[model samples]
Target: MEKLLGEFSIGLFFWQTVLFLALLFLLRKFAWKPILNAVNDREEGIKNALDSAEQAKREMENLQADNQKLLKEARAEREEMLKEAREIKNKMIDDAKEEAREEAGKLIAQAQASIQTEKKAAIAELKSQVANLSIEIAEKVVREELSNKDKQVKLVESMLGEATLN
Candidate 1:
């Protein structure tokens, strides 16, 4: 009976080895192959997502740089416009001042000419009045002298004597 049991144990060991080898082959063919493929696909998906995130980050940085450049340009343009406005303001002020000075000079000149004309007119009027007064005074003196008939006759004879000598 011990000999038969030993022989039966050898047959059992043989059957167990065959079943274990068959199970390992079936798992490799169905379960292990599918699981490895699934893990590889997930790894690829993760890698692609990380790549997209990196690309998005780079694009955002580029956009920010572009915005900064545009801002600088805008600030420069504003400064240029302000500078032009200030220059125009200054030019306008200078022009206005110059025009005012010219206008004032013209006014002064016109006033002086007007004064000179008035002075000349007043002197002419004074001379005419003096001439008229002198004429009136001479006429009065002659009338008084002529009021004496004897002196008038003597003056007439002297005038007639001078006329005959010519």
Candidate 2:
């Protein structure tokens, strides 16, 4: 039993040593370099992804700032346009008022001129009527006063001469 145990112990020790050496060689040849390269590649990939994220974040911030600037400029332009519109509206109103005043003055002047012409025509008609009435009154008075035929003829001749002199 001792011999059997001793031989088994020796065989197990030799096999364990051989297996250890073979495992060391396999790790060096196949496992160690690939694992280290995989770790390095993973780290480089993480770093590149972080850099790309930072760049995108900066670009987004710049875009946000540009948008704000554009918004402000648009508001300013709107304000300026509104101010110009108001000024133009005021000027138009003033011009319209001036035109209305001028038209009113012209209308008043025309009305006054029309009134003056009517007044002159009315006065001329009245003067003509008065002159005709005066001539009629004079003829009736003279016909009543001069009844004798010869005296009537002489008085009419003398009155005609006096009228011509006057």
Candidate 3:
């Protein structure tokens, strides 16, 4: 070991050490700076991408909430519309029923009035026929009782004169 160390010069070791240190310094100044800057830029880009992804996730959640709210409002509106339609339908049905009842009552009243008129007409005709039949029967009975022609002629003349005076 001592022989090997003695063969090499102290000046040669010093020159080699200085050359290695200068190469290291030059690499750090030029190559290492650019490489480090590129690495740092890549890291910043990754962080920005992560932040954008997180923002997109939050936006999606907000959109989902808005969609849910819109869906609920649509359902509520549909329910309200259905309720209103049912009410209107019921009202229309009731109105139609009432109209039918009114028409039926009118028809019944007309039938009753017609029946009453016919009954009154029949009664009047029956009374007139009865009166005429009573008159005929009285004439037949008087004719049957008066057998004498001269007495019947005198009775008829007096009845006619009394009727004319009245």
Candidate 4:
């Protein structure tokens, strides 16, 4: 115990102090700068990552807005197409009705014309029949009057006297 206590002296204390200071200098020169640089780099990487996340979020919002706008445009275009189709359908129906009316008018006119032609033909036939009957009656009367020879001679002398007076 006496020798152990005696071994603790100022020379050992001085050597220990020198060794501690040298180790501190070596560590400061080799290790401290690298450790601080590593910490700064990690901080910078974290900041960049956060900024990238914010930018991506903004881009997503813009994309969503664009999608909504496109959807509205598509709906409007579809409505317009539906309206046009309805208009076309109405026009076609109107055209069909007009065509039907025109065809009916033509048919009526043709029927009226045919009736008029038939009536005229009937009237003409009646007139011809009346003329034929009149001619037959006159021929019969003339034949009966001429059947008597004395009456025919008196008729001939009266006719000749009327002719001389004319």
Candidate 5:
């Protein structure tokens, strides 16, 4: 132990401390500034990259919202067009039905008018036939009675006696 203590001399310790101080000073002046500058540059690059990524994310979200709004507007316009088409179709159907009903009414009225005219014509024809038949019957009866002149004179005398002047 005494030998080991003896080896730790003041001169050796002072030289070692001097060398360490010189090395520390040299490293701080020549190496430390460039290394620290490199580290700071790398840190700045990483910060810029992170900021750009955040900006890109915000832009993508805005674009998605715009697309959704456009889709909703398109759907509403399509639905409105469909509703208008349905209204037009219903109106056309109603107009067609009304036209058909009017045509049918006109046809029925024409048929009734024709039937009334034919009935009047038939009644007129029947009356004419009946008048002709009565005239023929009266002529036959007068010819048979007048064939006998004596009987005709006796019939005329009886009619004259029953006749009134007024």
Candidate 6:
């Protein structure tokens, strides 16, 4: 310790101080300036990247909302179409039933008319047959009575008597 203190010289110390100050000046000019600039540029790039990420997140949220809205609209449209189809189906069934009822009514009316016409024709034929039978029976009875001359004469005499009294 005593030798180090004894060797400490003011001229050597002054020269060392000058050299240290020169080196510090050169380092500040060449190395520190570039290092600080690089750090500032890195900070700006990170900030820009964070801002872009935030914007992208906002855009993604907006797109999700739009997709949800579109899905809801599609569901509503599908339900509406189904409802309309069901209504159309029911209407078609009702129309078919009504047409069937009309056709049945027409067929029934035609059958009833045909039956009435047949009944009238049958009644007319029966009347004609009965009249022909009655005429034939009366002719036979007249021929038999005429064959018996005495009976025919008595029948004629009675008819004459009744006529004269009236």
TM per candidate comes to: 0.65, 0.59, 0.66, 0.59, 0.60, 0.63
Q: In candidate 5, residue 60 scores what lDDT?
A: 93
- Encode model 3's per-residue lDDT on 1-166: one tens digit a residue: 9999889999999999999899999999989999999999999999999999999999999999999999999999999999999999999999999999999999999999999999999999998898799779858966885788877888788878977985
At residue 20, what lDDT does model 6 achieve?
93
lDDT of 2 by residue, 1-166 (tens): 9988767876778999999999988997899889999999999999999999999999999999999999999999999999999999999999999999999999999999999999899999898888788778867876776676887888788888988985
In candidate 6, what are the lDDT values of residues 63-152, reduced to their tens digit?
999999999999999999999999999999999999999999999999999998998888888888887886687467768887999988
Task: Report lDDT per candidate.
Answer: 0.92, 0.91, 0.93, 0.90, 0.87, 0.92
lDDT of 4 by residue, 33-149 (tens): 888899999999999999999999999999999999999999999999999999999999999999999999999999999999998898888888887886697467658878999
Identify the runs in model 2 with alpha carbons over 4 angstroms from their true place. 1-28, 130-166
Candidate 1 lDDT score at position 124: 94
Write down the TM-score for model 5: 0.60
Query: Each model's RMSD to truth, in Å?
Result: 8.8, 8.9, 7.8, 9.9, 7.7, 7.8
Model 2 TM-score, all chains together: 0.59
List residue ranges in candidate 1 displaced over 4 A.
1-21, 133-166
Clashing pairs counted in every model: 0, 0, 0, 0, 0, 0
Put down candidate 1 lDDT per residue, 78-150, tens digits, no spaces: 9999999999999999999999999999999999999999999999999899879966985786688799999
State the weakest 10-residue window (summed lDDT) of model 6: 134-143
Cα distance off (Å), candidate 3, residue 1? 28
On lDDT, the candidate that comes out on top is 3
The per-residue C-alpha lDDT of model 4 at residue 80 equals 100
